[model samples]
Target: MSQTLPDFDQITDTLRALGAESEAAENHGLLCAMLCTMEGVTADAWLDIALSGTGRDALAPEPPEALVTLFDETRRQFDSDEFDFHLLLPHDEAILAVRIEALGHWCQGFLAGLAVGGIQQPESLPGELPEIIQDMLEIARAEGYELEDDGEDEAAYAELVEYLRMGVLLFREEFRRQYAKAGEGSIH
Candidate 1:
């Protein structure tokens, strides 16, 4: 029988990579635990297996005082300002859609970087991503009202686009409600 893996938190500190800031302390632990839960494997081992030898190393466990450090750094970056652009996205879907928009821009830049860097051999990127990723990408494109794919069936893509639009609208409302739940003087 196949054995279950262990869980672990997001501790990716490899080189100049800026890892995503996990939701909360509990989420941090849970993320780590979830990582380990699959096949009870280590983070390094999982990356090695899932990501084929990109030569990227597993992130080390963060120090206990990491939160404090982040807080201090964040405070300094903003200079105690009440400005935050997280308003338009209060829910997960909204956040994800925005992130996808950002990602699309980043991806275009990366593709350009590859050409500028004069890399002779093309590296395997976005390799073996699950079908769910494709679906999510399609969904995000739809959410942004983008329907520029000219190869596929137009009607079908339009339907999918509409569905994503509905989702985006609903998620926007849900996000606003969540911000409302946050109490008075909150950015919404």
Candidate 2:
């Protein structure tokens, strides 16, 4: 069976219970970016970043089971031969504004993840990556739109999401090629 993302609200609740301050969308975005850019990114490393500001210590609680499941399922999506990876965002039924805001947060987190994954100089990257990073920066700052109708706004939102999904896949492929050329092995 095809693995699917965990429920957004459920992951949100789990993160809250774990004292994580980041939203589910942002956290998932970070995870995707790290997986793409970092070699052998482990679940523990991701947890360290995701729970960074929570002030958790050695005596702190472990990540909840639901969050762990989310991490595994998301990683599986990237490894799938079907290219089924997708962003973790609020469902379509959510208010358009809420969804839009979440998408922005996701983009912000993705950019942050790229930095965390050691991509400090995006401008020097090969192919379309530099432009893609610029586009993500703009999307991250998005607040609201001035579309004429709800239908139009919905179409626009869907297009943006699709673009982001494809962009991420491209990043993964390009980075993998770079690593291979340098004999650095593949990202996990």
Candidate 3:
């Protein structure tokens, strides 16, 4: 069904979908922790993989060692902003519009970091690009600009983040469903 924009289940599902790529429950949990509140970041959903400098990208030529460091640093820089960005956004409502825009910045950095040599990702044509890239293309359709296409040609990396964003969007939709019936006289 072409669901309503205000559904609560959908929103929460968007919140959790980003962590699905992790094989380890702990990995998922840990990443999820970054997005959720302290009370929500419990052990049950925590993933073990620590976000650090040594994390490797199976596809990239440049071992993602430094990328890990960049991610941690970026996270620290953005951590405070996430809270303020969402402060006015209700659980089932929209997150900050600017944050959505900033997502492109993060995607650019992530994808650019994964590129090798110069211009274009190592992704070999036809269909090698991840689902995320396609999703980002879909997301970027509105803007109609070449995003994250740095000298490295990390479009595939951009795709990966786009996919993650799409997943998060789905999780958000699911969340809207779960919470649709919560609270009386609700303004959702």
Top candidate, metric lDDT: 2
lDDT of 1 by residue, 66-159 (tens): 3333333322322223322011112223333443443333223222222322322333212322232244344334435444445343455335
**Per-residue accuracy of model 2 over 100-154 as CA lDDT, tens digit each:** 8889889888998988888878898878988988998998887666556569889
The TM-score of candidate 1 is 0.22
The parts of candidate 2 lying over 4 Å away from their true place are: 58-61, 147-149, 185-188
Displacement of the residue 14 alpha carbon in candidate 3, Å: 29
**Cα lDDT computed for each candidate against the true fold:** 0.30, 0.85, 0.32
Candidate 3, residues 101-174, lDDT tens digits: the string is 43443343223322311214323322323454445345434343444524333445445444554443342333
Per-candidate RMSD, Å: 18.4, 2.3, 17.4
Clash totals for all models, in order? Answer: 18, 0, 44
> Which runs in model 3 stand beyond 4 Å of their true positions?
1-95, 116-129, 137-188
Taking all chains together, the TM-score of candidate 2 against the true structure is 0.92
Ranking by lDDT: 2, 3, 1
